[model samples]
Target: MKILNFHIRGKMAHFRRYYSNSSALSYSVPPRTTLIGLIAGLLGFERDSYYGDFDPEGCRVAVGVCSPQKKLVQTLNLLMIKSSNDLNGSRQHHSQTPTELIIPANIRTGFLDYEVWICHQNNDLINTLHTRLEQKYGYLTQGVSAALGTAQHLGWAESARIVEGEEVAEAQADFFSILPVSNVISLHLSESRHRLRLQKEDMPIHFHPDRTIAGKGNFLINASAAPVNAKVKTAVRLSDERFITWMED
Candidate 1:
């Protein structure tokens, strides 16, 4: 199978947690569902129209942090407008909402990078996506802009290419990408000597055609984009000597 490989980076990102309440929280990395949504956007699929086309059973996704990241919370003044007459803030009731955002750990770099790997059962779809991505990450040909979580926080993809991978036996190699929690047998936290940054997140994996979330997953990821020594299942070894765990349903 051929996989589309690319890295997305932006100044800031806020992938709000699925169950966030008044305080808008964010996930450290984009979940599988978010990756699928980005792929759909690149393919120019209409809103809520490509769930079935990219089902978990057919399309596989993996993500890895390529740059260090950190999150900060800021209070945003949200205007509460009930009707059209209140559009100009004539009747003002501003709610200070604490919003969390993900950014690069260092300010000088100015980009938070996330590497994405994806493959689909549909050969034509894969080819189409590879072509679009080659066209400057699809912005020119598709006229679709890429963003990290929201439109206000714009992002872009670079180095689009098709690469081959071999399915490896369980624990064949150490994983560099995010791994589903269920597939992790052990983590080598001590061997890393405090250099590895780990995080656990409950992320959405799949959605029904009707737009309801269908599957959720718990995953372990290295936030610093470093290698993690761990025994994991469903491993895939890329041609470039990188390993990843699939986001299975």
Candidate 2:
């Protein structure tokens, strides 16, 4: 399978957890759904109209964090709307609610960079996306508008060259991408070497309402203080550095 590799970066990002209510929590990396939305935007697909175009059966996506990351929780005062019909009355009814927002610690100079791997059975779609990203013309003039969680936090991407990759037996490395817990052949944590930590999250992969389920699943993400030794099974190699597994059903 051929995979298109790309880089995404931003000063700050927040991938909100769906289950969080009052306090919005964020995922460490962009979920499969977020990736789909980004690609759809670049393709100029209407909102909620392109879910099937990038379904798991046809397209696979993987993401890896490329920078040191830290999480911080902050509160924002948000206005609550009670009635839209009564403008004068709505002001009296509206109240400022303090909402907790989970965001990346470095909101200014500290950039959140990620390596993305996208593999699709359709070669034309892949070529178009790559060409558009590289030229930065037509639909992808400013690059696709990407956000970690909310639309308020914006990011950009450029065309990343695709390269050949090889599979190795084992190596000590920090994982920057989300992987299926079942596909992980083996994992080793070293506090002195890698400072590795494990985080498990339930992420939504598909948004098509027609499906029996919305395509939600659990994913295991690796967080490392530094790179660690690991034995991984991956089908595609990215940038001669990272190995990525396909997002499967």
Which candidate leads the pack in TM-score?
A: 1
State model 2's lDDT.
0.66
Q: Which residue pairs does candidate 2 place in steric collision?
A: 14-149, 64-176, 64-177, 65-176, 172-229, 173-228
lDDT tens string, model 1, 41-160? 888888789998888888999888888888899998877889988778777678889999998988676689888899899989988887777774244435556689967788888878
Candidate 2: tens digits of C-alpha lDDT, residues 55-145: 8988888877667676776666444555666544544535443333433345556677777888777888888878766765423633347
lDDT (Cα atoms) of all candidates against the true structure: 0.83, 0.66
Query: CA shift at 185, candidate 1, in angstroms?
Result: 1.5
Count of clashes in candidate 2: 6
Minimum summed lDDT over a 10-residue window in model 1 is located at: 136-145
